[model samples]
Target: MKWMEFSVHTAQEAVEPISNILHESGASGVVIEDSNDLVREWNGAEDEIFELSQEDYPDDGVLVKAYFPLNSFLKETVEEVKQSINDLLQHNIDVGRNEVTLTEVHEEDWAQAWKKYYKPVKVSNFITIAPSWENYQAAADDELVIELDPGMAFGTGTHPSTVLCLQLLEKLIKGGEYVIDVGTGSGILAIAAAKLGAKKVEALDVDETAVESARSNSSYNHTEAAVTVRQNNLLENTKMKADVIAANILADIILRMVDEAYERLNTNGCFITSGIIASKKDEVKKALLQSGFAIVEEQMIDDWVALVAQKK
Candidate 1:
């Protein structure tokens, strides 16, 4: 089928409005580039390698992407989508601005094309992400494995947040301990916890796509533990707790839920956190201390830190 390419140079400020318009208009997807031209996905794939990886865009500081397969309305009203985006950008009196471009694709198969870019990755010494399309060899006597494909959610263990969480989980989680992974992206952490010998594990993400990804990954591992996957927004039910909890979410969320996490842990239970920039480490530390969590261990890599703290 033919697809139309919608390109826009949108600042972070105008990205949301343009995204809302596209969503309301039933557009297939919209991709946004930040002020630095970094990649951000509003309604489509989350692969941002082009921004961070040099191989994809060797021409430094140039960020450009094409979104295709416009919905019926968007295809018919292509000019309308362009106008909405252009209007939103024009409304913002920012000095440096982005422009929008439109083009048509005679024929394309996005679903089949994206697979060529997806590859197997290893997050830890003990865990490897084998996409369903590739062959993964396990070391002799290896006890655990995790299998996944980049279907529709993040967390193939390639993201910094997921890797840091797994690193912290390996240390904080002992054999046969109960673990909770809030906002479990691809169930990567939950699968790792189960492999690390957690007697019971629970993984929940507010995003339904994430929940599905986690479930599929868990099943691929053939995990025996009760790795319950649910669609919950944090631990609203105060009656629950865990021996270990790993939340690799935004810094704002980590600070906001510090108290609830403290209240939701057994004495000596460790809480591991990641997805924090180095600049926000102090904020998290202060929140943890104020919430009665004693620092246990901390590690940082590539401008990201993961902290393991025990209940005081």
Candidate 2:
């Protein structure tokens, strides 16, 4: 079988969303090449060493690649992917060059193409995300591990947005709290919440593939007993009140759902949001405040920002 290798040149802030668009378009997996990663410093003897070549990365911004079967619907799928990516501009997301290119390759080539780009990453002080194929061991007694097979889904739990969410979840989740993870791609946050001692977790995503992926991941993490994965729009018709709610989606979607999140959280509950570009931080802050949330903590990493607000 043949496969289409699609590549996009986009800004760092646009990486997560664009990868998500690719996944929703039926890409089997994704590979990200960022110039910054080439120069990043690593600590600890267990950290994996990468041999990166300059030729593979852009001098600025990021390159995201995905693979899809070369089926009859390939052209239509590509057009839809491009249209969805272009739609990001309407929400004020910086898509950078937004240059997309495609190449054809054999199925064997696509199978191992993305593996080199993925490795176990320590996302937070206590959490590490490792691909299923990697051999990783916890360096600390307190560390927790999340085993995931990304398989075209969005959450690797290592992106700045996701790491910020995990850090806050570590701090905010008191034992026995109920948590809701909106747009739970890969079910990372929901599983983390469950492992962190949340009594119950409700994970929701609009994409059926994401929903299925989340369920599988929850089970893999042994969190299925505590986490429920469902296909539902963001917080729509969600009747269960939660002690903490996490949404690592775009700023616009987060803005639109602030009121619903505020309503669904219990008194003094925490609402953690990420996948917001730095420039839109204030805009999201304003929306949260207007919806009766008190901004408690703000975290910024590179060009992304994550805000933690409380229902007062």
Candidate 3:
């Protein structure tokens, strides 16, 4: 089969949202090429061994590429993707050049292109995320390895937003706590919670594809019995009150669901939210506070922020 390779030149800040756009548009996977990865200093020779080819990357800014199956609607899909990305400008998001290009490639070529971008990444003290194809061993006895195929889902479990969520989960989740992971892309957080000893975890996502991916991932991690993946909107008529509720989603969505999150938690329950840009930190915090949640901890990585709130 043939594939249409869609490439966009966007700013670092726009990568997450743009990649999300592609995924929603039916792209099978995304490949991020950031020039910073080439020039940034690394602590050891591990990164140096990758041997990046300068010709494949832009001189500045970041390149995000994704693959869509060549179909009758390919042209229309591309146009829709471009329009959605252009819409980002209205949100005050810097889209950089925002130049989009398309090329035809065979399935084999598209498959090989994404592999170079994915590797084993240690996102937190206890969690190491690796692609299903990589051969990675835990460096420590306490390390938890999550193997993900990623596919078209939004969460890789290694993004700063996700890493922050995982780290907070590691610190906050004691044995037998009940967890509800909203927007549970790839089911990483729910799986992590289960692996960290959560007695029961419900992983919820509005997207059926994401819900399916999360279920498969949970099964792969041997947490299927502990983590349940379901299709549900954010805290909509949630029947179960959990000890912890995690939502790694946009700040606006988080704001909209803050009250519901509070209502769905048991007394003194923890609400963890990430996928917030630093610019919107104060706005999210205010909403959480107004919803009667006390901000207990805040974490920032790069330009993203995560907040841990407790119901009093």
Candidates' C-alpha lDDT? 0.65, 0.87, 0.86
What pairs collide in candidate 1? none
For model 2, residues 1-312, the per-residue Cα lDDT tens digits are 988899999999788789878887788878888877777543224544445678867898899988889888999999999999999988777899999999998877777766666778776767888887886777789888888886654545667788889989999987999999999989999999998999999999999988889999888889999999999999997999999999999897899899999999999999999999898899999999999999999998778899999999
Better of 2 and 3 by lDDT: 2
Quality of model 1 by C-alpha lDDT: 0.65
Flag regions of model 1 displaced more than 4 Å. Answer: 1-54, 57-68, 72-108
lDDT of 1 by residue, 133-186 (tens): 676556436624567764622424555556678767776666878888888867
User: What is the TM-score (0 to 1) of candidate 1?
Assistant: 0.72
Clashes of 1: 0
Query: Against the hidden reference, what TM-scores do the models get?
Result: 0.72, 0.93, 0.92
lDDT of 3 by residue, 185-226 (tens): 889899999999999999999989999999998998899989
Candidate 2 whole-model C-alpha lDDT, 0 to 1: 0.87
